[model samples]
Target: MIDVLIVDDDKLVRKGLMSAMPWDSFGMRVIGEAANGEKALEFLKENHVDLLMTDVAMPVMSGIELIRIVRKRYPDMAIAVLTLHQDFEYIQEALRLGAVDYIAKVQLEKERFEEVLGRIHGLILNQRRKPPNEPASVDQDVYPLDTAYAVLGLGDHPLVNGPRQHSQGWRVEADGHILLWTPDLREELWTEVNSDREWLPPLPDQALDADWRLVRLRHIAGLTQFDLLQMVRNYRQRDFFYDCNGYETNPIEKSVQELQADQPEPSEREIEAVKEILHAFRWVHDSQSFEELCSQLRKLRLPASKLMQLLYGFIVDWSRLFKALAKTGITLPDTFLCWSEVVAWMGGFREVAATLSGHLQLSREVTVSIMSAVKIAHDELEFPLFAVDVAKRVNLSRSYFNQCFKAIVGYSFNEYLRRVRIDKAREYLAQTAKPIVWIAEHTGYADEKYFSRIFREQTGLLPSEYRNRHRQR
Candidate 1:
């Protein structure tokens, strides 16, 4: 049975909630009750609970504060909020602090209450089975690759970008690229076809798929247990854990298998440094003062490359928090790809700081402005929708608008427009049997060749190849 705790300031309310539900039916039992966050903390110090359901308002400490404290202290524990109609704001804040669900205080009937309890129970069980840091393991005995050969050197691509149906095989990563094992004989066939690096897989109406830039290894015959282990080590440094795009249905199990001791824990001074940088980022959004923020960043006295890495790590940390807060998919721009290029393109750490601050302020008016602009641009993607056009609608200058948009949305106006169009093209390719020319035009491209070029640049696949691969999936 799952242990539970109830926290509310009102004594009668706490008692009523404790007795209101048949928690045992849902494999839960209220092990304790507290009248406020203070009492709850005291209880938690002496006891343990799988779940904590608390009221938003309380004396000594508010529920929001308690949730923050618990999130930092006991991250694995599930949390829920007790909220009245006017307390929804608190519930939102609670959820931002990692609350799993919220309960309407007035609707604590047995049926509704049991349903919510059951869900929390299931969530706890599911999370126990799959921690975020642990990779899913695969059985090599059942899926042997001894008779097959592998193709290596395919650069970063989506892990699940494979045919829907095929004989048993696995895609692995090595040397900062991907490898695929399958029954194969001709090593020269792929080399000759992709000699110019032009042809790709999943071509429209093609019965046979081509190897998409994956170089077949002639010397290495088949995959062994040692090969898989080495693949894990190769992937450990490829930032695969930070890249959120390739998690679903990924065959590579050890995507985040970094050596902990090698990755030295941030020293006490380093933690304080990051906190100072975060404070500066927060101050920028609050005061709209870029100079003061830059002054803070400059005070760190780190070189440009180290500064970029620090900023990148800061963004990664916040991205994780943003994902938790929004309970939605939030992928940062792959700007961490080349630090020198990103620093040069961003002009300095100041712009990078500003951009990250904007991303952190998702609930602010600045976010609303950018989102409105996105809606308008997406509505008129086929037309020549320019940044100036969006700025005009949002009542801001193009230059300032681009700055805020990049900060808040993590991409410039043109880059976002292209990405949105490409995303639409992906949808069309996957869902419809339209011709490549039709898809290109339908997604705002007048020339199919231009569209294909942009598509390859964005997705590493031609229109036909993407369509075929996604369609099969």
Candidate 2:
């Protein structure tokens, strides 16, 4: 049976999960339970666990922290995050940290338990069967080509009946279009009709069903199956950006190498222009300035990849500048697949920028006071600090200060204090050979054991273990 450990801060949640799930029938057993990440780590240290089911938010150590530590310490163990709909950002982090799957808490009762268990079990088995040292192959059938072939798009043609099987050559379907890669052009697939371009053939509408029509049929040579799919995607993205009528008959004669070489880095002038736009946008909230910025971006002739890189840099800057002011739940996609996606993201960010600009315009004084309080908190981490004391230092009532603090910082004063203290403790443990007791005392914990408990709760590892782990790294 697969030995599982369930970790959650809620006693009721842990007990309910343990009792409600039919573990025996699924060939799994919940051999252990933990109140939080720290307790989970303690249980893991003493027992052999095959799978760990954990919640995202908890009292001391967060599910993200637990997943990070567990992934490193127990690379063989499978992890599945227990998440709510609101915990999307945390869930993303968990998945990036090697979580194989997620169980939605809200859907647990609504969905079939057997199906969930079966899916988890299948994923765990697949993960175990993978070799540790090599990257997982995207497709087992992917093989290097001795001679690259031309890839053609056959748009929803009934000539090809099934998926991944075509008599002409290797076939792959993407976005309702069938892509075929062959050594030579098959004339039988198309009918000669009126065409402005000599190389292009006009598709016969009578041959297709009423539901289907011929889209663009162009060919690019020197591509493998993987490269063919990628080229098709690039073509689609190009079509979207250019607003092309699918009838463009021009063949893509440029090789993949040529395409790669065409994507140049943003020049120094472009970089400086972006910086100027960002500065102006942040400090000056004129609608005309926003329009000008968008116009300038649209006028650029940079490839989608380079444009995305520039935009991603802008996103990073915005993230750093408005981190405290922005809601903690907001998440931006790390990569954009096409120009349309980038445009959509920019539109969303425009709304966010307007909201943040309003905050800056109306709450300049509050922002300054909160920032001062944060600076004081950072500077005075060694001593006992309380919200009431910080509020007094910042010249505000305790309750009012808390309201502004949470509004601007996305965390309560006490929670932020604990996080900073533990963060400092972590730095000391990792960078220095200092005694655990001294580190604890210096980080505002009077008792070493109590400090260790809190540290474990935040990090899922004791001070010594954390230090040792970092040292090994």
Candidate 3:
């Protein structure tokens, strides 16, 4: 039988999950539950959990960190994340760290949650592929969601965060389920039944976070396994790209349509600008902070062209990220898609900052710490948070965190952060299919011309051309 743990600070979430059903009948059993990630990690060291269902945001230790540690030690561990809609960034980070899926706690009731769990349990049970290189875990029960499910919420969650993990119903019958919905459910929870008027259990008095709930949505149907998986992937991608360096705030669907209204590029231009920008930015460039160049552009010395003439020497940043991912042969996904896709699949400014800070540096721990914070900031879409602040969140120190990060990631805090923002702009130009002006604002570069110049330098292709070239399938 599969060994699993249910983690959530809210007592109701925990209680509802616990009483949902006994896993032994479904080829699994509940091993334990923890209130927080720190506690969960401690439990993990002494015990083994084949699967994990956890909340993303929690005090002491966020679910993101817990997954990070778990993925490192147990890559095959099946993971599901739970968080509020506002916490998409956290979900994105967790996705990148390898949580297979997420659920909006307010959405589905315990019954639906258990159904999804059954499907996930099915996927885990069905998986037979083993990493060719790594030693196989003796636990045959450990399984990850299929890639399709990873991006979808488990499978067709109407919302980015919902109970979409399960495709069909559960196998065994419950003796009796006392359906409970959290009293404070602000809005109707995602695609599930809430009609059961069963009184729900309350959260533990010591629960963390504000506004806990026990909820069940009513009348959920027409959801199949395939449809659900697609939904999860779509949401996963959206969350990943939501705060990426190049995230356009709008979808390429617009640009795809606009391509009809606007004329194609002049024959002479030929997207050479894109080529030039990429060529220029092979190294030295980071975060669109070229002052002398910006000064001249501000003075009207250069033409206001769509070409990314400013971006230069940014390949180093890309190189760093590329190298890191190559270690796993996993390509990071693009940011700026709609919600519900693979978390790592999204990439952008926030991603660049985190990647450059940690990967550009030679140091491992400092890089890891910075990566942790950047990831948190990216998940939250808030940046420039203090080093100390990031350190504290990741349970590190100002000095040791700095040292460890520098030692592993290979860039000092400031220098690496600069690279992150700039590279994010470059990526935006190439990936998001957004306008140059908008890309500048999102990547922390207010000046469009300067942003363009930096783009040209780093990518050797002007913003538009680079985008065109990469945009072509």
RMSD of candidates 1 onward, in order: 24.0, 19.3, 25.9
lDDT of 3 by residue, 62-156 (tens): 88888888888876688878776524433556655656556766445533555556556655654434455756322212112111111111112
> In terms of lDDT, which candidate is stronger, 1 or 2?
2
Among these predictions, the greatest TM-score belongs to 2
The TM-scores, one per candidate, come to 0.29, 0.32, 0.31
lDDT of 2: 0.63
The ten-residue window of minimal lDDT in model 3 covers: 170-179
List lDDT for all candidates, in order. 0.57, 0.63, 0.48
Task: For candidate 3, report its TM-score.
Answer: 0.31
Per-residue C-alpha lDDT of model 2 across residues 1-473, encoded as one tens digit per residue:
89999999888889988998888976899999999999999999999999999998888999989999998999899998887642333355676577766776755752347645765776676666678887743322333322223333322223333334344454434222434443223334332311223443333232234222123333333333444444444443333333322344444343444333333334678867866775433323345656677666665544444565676676565454446744534456755534446556666766664576366453544555676677666668889999999998877889989987887677889988888899899999988899998999899999999999999999999999999999899
- Most accurate candidate by lDDT: 2
User: Where does model 2 exceed 4 Å of error?
Assistant: 86-90, 137-473
Better of 1 and 3 by TM-score: 3
lDDT per residue (tens digit) for residues 437-471 in model 1:
99888788999999999999999999899987886
